[model samples]
Target: MENVEESLELHDKYQFEVKFTYPLDKTVPYTEYNVETFMFIPNNLCVNHTTYTKDDFYSDMQKYIRLKTPTMLLKNILNDDKSPLKALKEAMKTLVSEPNNELKMLDYKYHLKMFCSIFKSALRDETIFAEKLNDKEDAEDYIKSIIDSTEDIVKKFRDLKDIIHVPGLENKCYALYLFADEFVSLSLDKYRYRMIFNLDKAEVKNKKKIRSELIDLLSAEIEYRKSARYNSCPDEKSDNEELIYRESTLKKLMGSVLFLKTQTMREGIYIEQIVMGLAAGLAMAFATAVAFLSQSKLENFTFSLFMIFVIAYIFKDRMKELTRIFFHRKIQKRLYDRKTNIYNSLNQKIGFCKERFAFFKEKDIPELIKKIRNKDYITELDNGYIGEDIIYSKRFIKILSKKCKNLLDDFNVDGINDIIRFNIRNFLGKMDNPTRPLFMPIEGDIKKIKGGRVYHLNMIIKYGMINKQDIYRKFRIILSRNGIKRIKEIPLTI
Candidate 1:
């Protein structure tokens, strides 16, 4: 009883002496207190008190103690009765050496199923989107749904893999995981989204513009027709007539738009077809070559090899040329039709006058020029109008002079002319008779030519051998009369 009384007295005395320093007439700074002092403060006195109950504190204390204890020591203590730790260690070692093959097989099966399901889902989405593209909003919603579905499937696979454990299963899981990431990455690619968005925007803008222009034009025409009718002979006509006319005009315009769209689609299809055909042709050629090589005897190996290589080369070259010609022809046809359409439209709007005087005449020259006269600038040249006299006339000379002047202003023509002269001399030097000029004389020293340099027409004549003196003489006379006298001199030799 005395000892208990002594302890209580000691505790009271200690509590009385423990005085927290509160700044007088100023707020006490919480940070000044030591951790122990701060912790000792009562709930009411503490600045930011957390009300942790006794049970909560005890649980947290237990957890801290558990974490502080060494793992090995804890294991030993736990297995003191039956040595479960040793057994578990041995089991783990065995598991490492000889993993559960059955589990691995099951994982593989699950993985394959998931892969197939993903592919099926993707195909389904593509089909649905392709079939139901009547509305743009619906199409976008469908795409988003597809992406979401894909992401969900990937997550499912990930979750499935997480619960399973087997040797090499992780590797397979990792591969599948990477594949999922790739699929997601492709779907999320900003560039792909931008491309699709841009295409859709362009299509929308073009459609809007076309519709606006058509409506305005139609309205103007209707107003004009109404005015003309009222002025000429006022009569109450059936409203159906105007409606029918408008409908017909709209239909015609829509038909033209449809035609353009069809042409574009057809061109794309043709390109794809040509590419597939070329690929197939190449595959066939390779297969044939391999079969021929396999069947050939060792004695004729060199000859067969040579023949195969030569044939392959020839085939490849021919195919390249054919493709080039095909594309060139398509481009040419499109350009020709476009030009023709433009000309026809212009002619319709502005009545066709005499061919020579038509302002909107389809000439090779840029349409920027306001007026074109027959003797304007000593040139009346047209790409479509070809004749010997036109080719050799002052008009042609003036056109060439103007073009040459532009070229000279834009580039170092003197340097280019030098390069041309050097190449020509080098080419001529290779011949047997180097001193004797192989073609007609170029009218003057090419190096000394002023703004423009002249190339002899005969040098281009077949094999640099044919020299038509009459042509050269005529050319010279034309040039001299046109005040273009500085021509490169070359001997005429056939």
Candidate 2:
């Protein structure tokens, strides 16, 4: 199952998280390698008229987008039947009982890493879900559940630490304890802010209570962090540096324990390079032939012969460039822009993700895409008057389902999360002011009114899987000179 959530991030950036879940139960027997996504930009806001180019778009994407290593979903980690935390606790018990067993010790470390990474992520997911709850009762329940779960987990960690007298592992145990404490504080802090900004006035009392509880949790976390065992600032750095140091240390620990690893490389780069080399050779052959023919005909060092040679050189250069461009375009048509390989913690390859980007004219767009765009329109006159430019992006993902399911013997692992954040700063350069003054007649006298000037950039994505019906989603991104104004989902009825 594939799910996507989209929202605006910062002021000029749009973020979307795509969750690819591989279910353990018998169902569709196909891979998700045929997904295609498209974005339609107004001509005035595109490279055709503005200064933004394909290179700029790609650069911005690289800066903003993030592809996190695939891990188990929060629900899966928190599942009562098969919890990583529970498994971790059991592993710890065994390690403490038989510390000399190297294989058992390694198993304990693996479980510890899996629990820490998944626990942190699951808390984040749960907190976000809690904040989005509309029912006050549900919100209260979720908040309480989070607090109870964290407190119980922390207590268990403390108990385990008390028993862990094994030398050379104090730092690891203390780090896990601190990680749980700090993450709860951070997640609750975020929840408190969400309640203040997102919840309604009717829940003022409940919100206040939640806020108070969150503050208490944060205070406890702070006190725990300041305890003697876990130093707040060992290096005696400034406050900001101390916070950075703690976060950096925690991240390093997490990296060490993470199960999945990823490596990205430019797709088809070698073959494309070879194709370009062949193109250059072809162009050079033509140029050499021209030079030979010119030399033979002239047979003298005269002005005419010099002119002929110069013309041949110019044509040769032009021919090489033209041929190179032609071959590049052909390569683009056949290959993706980038490829990412996914590997297990054991350094074995499991799956790969491939993505491509391109520009398309209206005439070149698919009929279904055009239909989705023109839905409910009174006429085609708008398109005729102001033709839009289309930007196409595609993803081909392939995962070994059995490998992911068997990642952890305790529970089935969830698939990858492709988090893409796109910045629209490039599209804002050519936009007019956010508001333009308009003169209007008011009671026989002319009055000025400030009218909003905005542009709409539509994006339509097609999600495809073998033997499964494709799903389509369209979004209208309202923009101004300042940045993105808002994004509205256009429902598909056809």
Candidate 3:
């Protein structure tokens, strides 16, 4: 990460750092990742020559990637009359400018999805997305042809890093069509898209103004969207009422899915209720009752024996199992109801969207943008934030595993599987921070690393170096905070 940071600082010309404000000892979302031990962790940032924290930086990157970068790429595509992105740009404009027309929305969505696919492929192999214009007649065909010509994914993002040219560094001016869709995730997941500038410091008053302006721009955009959405109601309808009515039932249910999934801190399948194993408990209870009552000759003795039996068989042990099972079932039922409702609602919404070529209403796009763009900036870059450069350590570790094919991309640098390595991980830096994996660049990077070094893998296979199967042999990777250092190489015994 430090190397990547240095590369960017010189290439992108911006200072980057990670904050340890949140205790590295505490169990954060990245607990299992052991990521803290190997990679950097950031609580804040100073990029594009401004300042930001986790939340604000994430929001800014999301808008820039989905809107700004894509829009710039469209402009790049327009330079060639036959570029597929031209169709995309036109569709995007139609989607944003027109009212809620499902047809237009579908067109834009389709184009955006294809554009992202091509963009991702380009990142893997560095195939220039803007080349070979006037070759294909249809946009999809053009994109498909590019994809078809490419070899399987090559993880190096040489062309991509050039596109997303650092928007910050205050004084740097980046070229258009340089947006690399996967680089944001590369920086963020590795905890590299961070800085040490505190917006409250008094020395950075000038830089603070720029940061504040961008933050204010984000905030204002959000507030504007809220107002627009609120004011978009037709005659006789209030904004609040209309807004609620506009959201499909599926959206509400899906929103509830988030609530249900995390309601418990348990590892997986949050057994809200246990629904199995009850007949045996009941049988044991009945058998014990009958046996205790069968001895009637000595009333006191029978009662004592019965009490002992009940305590030993039912109350002491079986009852706990019985109670747990019953309660688990109850929770299971509750969760089942909510989950079923979400799925059913989702199906219904999908049906509706399918029935007609539906998309966000035209009025809704700006409002949505306003709402998405607008957000509160917790740490403001005020005039007080002026000072000398602040330096912070950034940890970067490299891992290479063959049988553990998924380790790097599917897992973590610290050897923790991704299931436990929480914290919003994505090549996309994901929009809205749902902590999901929409764009996975880690796996691609792993594929690109050859002979313990990060880069393309052309020589290893076609050039007759190591066999493709030899790449997956097992080995021990000694871990460190300074970075991953080769301790001892253990060849696969098997």
Candidate 4:
């Protein structure tokens, strides 16, 4: 199974996160996902093959895959009977109980790191959700729950720390403990400010109370981090160095547990070399045939023979180039632009992914997609006057599901996340000024206004998986010469 989520990352960048999941009971060890994005650019932008080439697109595009964030709810993680906290506590207890088991020790450390990552992710989601709540009571309730759960979790972690006396694991535990503490404090502080921004004047008392509570919590963590006997930083380091190094180290450790290693290469390199060789051979055969025919017709190095030789050389060069171009196009249709091999930390290859990009003619697009794009327009004449150029980008992903499951057997890791970010600054070069002067008559008086000029970049993303129906999403990106105004996702009924 596959899921795709799209959002605007920055003023000029668009992001898409594709998640691929494998069935637990299925015998097949692999799953494939195919995604195609067709971008329809306005004609006024003058975006075409000459203006925006494949190289230009590749330069502005970035793609990478990482293990999906484990799903652990903030409320459940701390207070539930069968929670991730309980699981990690049990894992660590087992490791401390059986100190001789190397595998258990490694497993315990893995769970600790994973718990830190899961808690941070869950915390971020909960805070964002709480901030977005429309009802004041609902937001207050949610924030209270977050505070309560975090307090419970912190108390439990403190108790759990006393259980870990093993010298080897103590340092790792302390580092992660500090990391989690800092993350919780920072997230709560940010939430406090954002929620305050959304509060009205009448809610000043409630806002002040909320801010005081969050600040108290964060201040306590800061003091604990500073005065703890097992300092996360070395005594020889200065305060600033210790702060920067500690943050960087903790982030690197988190990334080590979450991100996968990948190796990329140009796809079908050998086949392309072979195609070129064959084209050369065909050209050589033509040249030899011409030489033999000319010698048989005119014996000496005369004007006629020289002319034939010159013509043969010209035709031979043209034939070789034309043949190469034709066959390369054929090859591209069957192959991809690049292939990436995914690997785990142990250097075990998990799977491979492929990607391609091209510009498609109107006739080449699918009927369904074309109809969907034109559905909003009332008449066909609209397309004639305001037509769009189409750009197609494709991604094919295949992974050994069993391998991924085995690597993350202890946790509930469902899939891999393929994140793609594309910058659209290249399309802005030919754009007109952001605003134009417009004159209008208002109540029999002449008035002038600055009318905004913008372009519509309509995009349709088609996603498919094996043995499943395809999914489609449409988005319209409004852009001016300055930057992107906004991105709107259009609902799809067909």
Clashing pairs in 4: none
lDDT of 2: 0.65
Per-residue CA lDDT of model 1 for 325-414, tens digit only, reads 666555533321110111111122111011000011224323221121112221223112221111100000001122222221311121
- TM-score per prediction, in order, is 0.19, 0.73, 0.27, 0.80
Q: In model 3, how large is the Cα lDDT of residue 24?
A: 14
lDDT of 2 by residue, 1-494 (tens): 35433333333344333333332222333245456767777666645523656566667664212223335545455456667767877887787777778887778776766666666666667767776677878877777777777667656545665545466554665455556545434444445455445444435337777767767766666676667344442243455666667666765566465435788888998988898888889878987897788788888888987887788788888888888899888878999888888777667776777878777778888999888987335223434566777778787877665555445555444434454567777777777788989999999999999899887777787775555667687787787887777778888757
Model 1 regions lying over 4 Å from their true place: 1-132, 164-176, 187-195, 202-494
Ranking by lDDT, best first?
Answer: 4, 2, 1, 3
The model with the greater TM-score, 1 or 2, is: 2
Off by over 4 Å in 3: 1-83, 89-102, 109-117, 127-283, 286-475, 481-493
lDDT of 1 at 26: 13
| Residue 264 CA displacement from its true place in model 2, Å | 2.8
User: Could you give candidate 3's per-residue lDDT for residues 1-494 as a string of tens digits?
Assistant: 11111100011111122211111111222211011111111112122123323333233221000101111232233244544355555664565555367777555544544444334333333223322233323322433333333211212222333322343312211211212222212221111111112223213324444345434533443364355343222344445654335333322322221121111112114443223245455556665665656555445655677666665565536565666677665553333111111012113210000000011222433332323222224212321233111111112111222322222121112221111111212211211222223333594553332233211000000000122111211122222222223323333333
Cα lDDT listed for each candidate: 0.29, 0.65, 0.28, 0.73
Worst 10 residues of 2 by lDDT: 21-30
Q: Listing every candidate in turn, what is its Cα RMSD in Å to the true structure after a full C-alpha superposition? A: 45.5, 5.9, 24.2, 5.4
